[model samples]
Target: MSTFRLAARVLGLAALVALLAACATGPRITTEADPEADFSRYRSFAFYSPLAIESRGYSSASSERMKAAARAEMEARGYVFTTEKPDLWLNINAYTQQRTDVTSMPTVDYAYYYSYRARGYYVVPYWRDRTDVHRYTEGTLNVDLIDASRNRLVWEGIAVGRVGRSGDAAERGARIDGAMADIFAQYPYRAGMVPAPR
Candidate 1:
């Protein structure tokens, strides 16, 4: 890969790690649900047979952790986990992309001048404008709830944040769990009950 692309990938990986590891103060989360769809009618949940995050006919480790996280959240909400027919089916997706940030600011620059009278060098300071370009990775996690019978989306949660470059599988899994919890906390409905106004 090109140097730029490689740097972006590294930054992206870092951002993904940060996105999962730093939940309370890092990721920004948003959620939306189908206004017309009744949440109370849903009592059971299942993951899509082939999750959106899957590739080459297999599931990724991150996808498996995401599934486990979602299952916990759903079950806590009184939704049963089932592979068979379910009232709701969830599609989970995670991805990272390179982002560029450009900033400009006024900076102080220094220069030295030779002074014959003083027989020494004098320091002169001036104001200079500078611009900096920064490259980093942005990670996103999306959870979509679909009506199995109608095969239509009913609710969705999205999280976006800078991913840091650190963590092992266990740590990543914990972070994924944190991210999932943050997403589900936005879910306003319980099984067989309408969402209360927030």
Candidate 2:
């Protein structure tokens, strides 16, 4: 009922809101490449067979979307797509898992202030312990680039983030696109790097 208690509660709520906001913004992206691989030799790429992805329980449509996104990104980086004898093989995979986050809310401490007896003011300290349990889905998408000749992984990019429960196809597609963009932005090679006529 007192102003001091109300202020403390307001501060706690503000902190909670900020924490949740930070979690909703975007996915975390990571990329790695083999130092010994010759990136310049890779001028073209092709997607792995649909059967390969479908065997992992992903739908054909999902595979198409991932391939399309990767194709666009690769082309932008000066790589062409080919169905036969490509220099690199591209594979996309994704998985989701349910997670529960438990966080302890910030505690507030108060100190007592004393003054002269005739015009004295006294303060009481309070402590509040709160725990929050949040349930959500975490999703991860991986883009793997393999050297077709050697059949070895040369580069990989992964994006991980919170997934929503909505079944809307359009919204999900947009999320995938955003995540792919973040992933491919880290590709080490640049576009238009072909060798000159010898």
Per-candidate TM-scores read: 0.79, 0.78
Q: What C-alpha lDDT do the candidate models reach, one value each? A: 0.85, 0.82
Candidate 1: residue 106 lDDT (0-100): 57
Candidate 1 TM-score versus the reference: 0.79
Which residue pairs show collisions in model 2?
Answer: none
Which has the greatest lDDT? 1
- Please identify model 1 stretches exceeding 4 Å from their true place: 1-25, 114-123
lDDT for position 92 in model 1: 92
